[model samples]
Target: MVSAENSSLEYLRSLVNYDINSILYDDTLICSLTNNTDVGSFEVKVTKTNYGNLHDCIQVIANSQATIDGVACGTTVRAVVTRELVTVQQEHTEYVKLPNPITRIVDFISESTDYVITITNEEGKKKTTETKRIPKNEAQGLILEGANLILQRLMIQRNMPDKVTMLSLDSSSELSRNVYTSLGPQQVNINGKDIEAWGIQRQIFETKPNALPIAWQSFFSIDGHLISRYQVGSPIKMKTRNIPEAEQFDEYLPKPEIPKRELEWENDLELRSRFIDRRDELIDDYKSYIYQHPDINALLSDFLQSVLITKPENIIDYATEFFAPFNNQTADRSLFRFADEKIPVPKPNISLK
Candidate 1:
């Protein structure tokens, strides 16, 4: 006789089985970022190809690329296999070339008892680890499969508990149970049509009870597909779109370059903390630009600030609107005006006309 916990675990394991034939048939999906306050608007295209053979062992291959501010930030590819309702023998690579160039490659090969993870980065950095044998019910490996796996797990346990612990391949922290509160059926307007989906409040990272919860939310379909996601109270919502072929994204994937500086940071806690603070400050500076020009889409700032050639007319109206409120001629205008035509009209008719 199976206990309730065991039964639930078994059900969770079944949903994550990588051998799900329907999901592997040369599929393409487009996910686009949507929001007014979003720092950057981006799109991700994922493609999956299936190689149906036993000897190949590398049964499924998935490729994903994300572009932010009209530039390719990174590309990831994964080769995954399934055995006994568990995804194993994953080969993965992350190529990042935006802001800086970095390449991270991970290979996980299954042994009799456990799996070994070998990682290599662009700077000739390498690290290897042996993972404990994952139980049938556990979750691990590439996000292409892990996302769907976790979604299925959450859908199954939606009514059971508000918080549940799950395993992960990440080494920064131990496996922790994340709190999830259902927002119930939300009416999502997609492409001008209303579709009902379940909303779940998620903690993007672990935080103390008294500390602020970095709120992230995901909306899932009745069939447990993630249709949309965003930070709570944020206007930005990333939604899914249909794609004809995965090859459509090939042109957008840029070749990665290695940076000159040492990419690896030394093990210094205080220095790391200060570095994190500096990083946040840089982000705050980016936010200042957006805050100053609220009418302009934040995504356009990259083009306005970086590109040598631009249609200034496209952004001139936004700049005019942003400064219109502060247009008053508070300062002495007579001393500064070379042509009198540049003077303010509202303030004592300073204009010569």
Candidate 2:
């Protein structure tokens, strides 16, 4: 008789064989570098492919138009493993073509259990380094990049309790293990609708004594969609109201144009001019880092000057993306408060003063 755990792993293997193990999700997420949110999208494809003698392949690509470290960046990560999901190969590339041109590509190959990492520079120079052999469990469970959907699926499939230690493939270092504690299932409201989700806490610990671990909480829907994610120290959040079906969107379509009129504050001529001017300034400085930049005070001063402009009712929807790097709710409220102060109301022609 096959155990439930074995049955779950077997089911995952079957999905890989038919190339049905894939997910596409879109979201607005905060960038840690800019401290602002953007229309971030993630696509993950896992298929059965023949890479040398290995056949399982996993690819993750993420893109955001927001600036990171003073540059617009996008990343694609590819990982190949055996049927059991043990690492056989991994590769990552980061491309930044706006404001500045920068590209980094690295490859990791597993040979006799040890990993050899090779990095290629723009000059085509190659550097190679080696890391000690990773444990089979760590290699099998390493998450290169993607939604928590995969992890959540496995957790629920196996009925795992307590915590699970999964390796984070963010870096080649062996210390990137993320320990996730399952908080069980909870009910949450999404888009004014109630839904049941699995809440999980992810923590990254350091080898140093008494050091604080980077931690965050993530929630996934029963159908394996990552619905919400929150981190400490910042009120920023990431959520997807719906999980998109595969191939529902076309990738080669022409990019849509931004609506100029939507941002124009026409009710007040002065407000309209100021709002338009500020929007132009932000577009000009789109490449600049918003979080603790070298001239942060000057940048904030200029940004504060624009706060007096009359904010549109839909400002919250635009502020998260337009503010580029400001705290989301804070920026939204400041605009609202500024609008309240500037817009005067006549009280039925009655004066009390």
Candidate 3:
């Protein structure tokens, strides 16, 4: 005669073959017993794959109608268990088209005689007319480099400058007193190579009173005909924002002065332990609050569902790609490899008595 344990084991083994094995990296497990007979209670054991180690094994009390087979079976019994996976693979791909380059230069004059340059190319066009405060000695060189850098940065932001190199500032001459006297091209050594460089000559002037002067000059390139020339100087007036005055906290009270204190070396371990304990307490409190507030949980679930449903797939792709570099293996495993192993399913255990 087959014993009840043997029969139950056999039944469980058969059910394991037919029961759908779902791969849920991080999800909740829901189990419901619709029918049973002569069963007072049941035991379930969960094991980890690859390791074959027992994760959790426990027995659940049967309900009023629940039974081993059918006699002691309960009307309806349900169990929900949630497990968190250490690693997960979420794949995403994005297709981007490159932009054109600037072929023409556009001139923009500010209200205060500040000249700005905009370049248009095959891929796209970029313009910068606002005057940026720059040191007089490095103004021209920075203007050349900064403008191109700004455009390149913008293209990078737009995800356009892929596999293409644009003309940019290679080297610049420093401002010197000699620049005021010498009107000829200056010999500069750049990257272990001596080259005759030219552009606008930079000179320091005492009369200008906090202003630097840059004189337009010519450079002798390897091919010879002066490649670039520009003169940059101080602006007559800088633009500023109008901020409203903040209201005084006390109309007549005098402002209090704070006394500075010297640094002290307290017990770091104790401090850290206190902080961690406080943090854990706060987190536990929050979880308890959430558990007590079923309405809030329902509202949150609804909000999350709505967000996931209404979010554009492309925007998610873009955001994922943008943050892919920063996420760790647990967060962004898909970015690094194709055949990464899936996270193992956690065993179900009795978390509460």
What's each prediction's TM-score?
0.44, 0.47, 0.15
Which candidate number would show the highest TM-score if scored against the true structure?
2
Per-residue CA lDDT of model 3 for 147-253, tens digit only, reads 22122212222223112211111112222221212234466443345566432333332233464444333232332222222234411111111111222222344
**TM-score, ranked from best to worst:** 2, 1, 3
**Better by TM-score, candidate 3 or 1:** 1
In order, the Cα lDDT scores of the candidates are 0.48, 0.55, 0.30
Best by lDDT: 2
In candidate 1, what are the lDDT values of residues 1-353, reduced to their tens digit?
11123344454465544333323233333444553333333232223333344332324444555665655644354544443324455666767565556677666655555555566667335344433343333333222233433443236334424443333343222223344456777887666777777777655333334544456677656544555665566444566553122211123336889788764454778878889999999999999987898866854564455434544655767555544544565434454467546756665757688
The clash count of every prediction, one per candidate, is 1, 0, 32
Model 2 segments beyond 4 Å from truth?
A: 1-39, 56-65, 68-71, 94-106, 119-143, 146-149, 168-172, 208-211, 230-236, 243-353
* Backbone steric clashes in candidate 3, count: 32
Ranking by lDDT: 2, 1, 3
Provide the RMSD of all predictions against the true structure, rounded to 1 decimal: 30.3, 29.3, 44.6
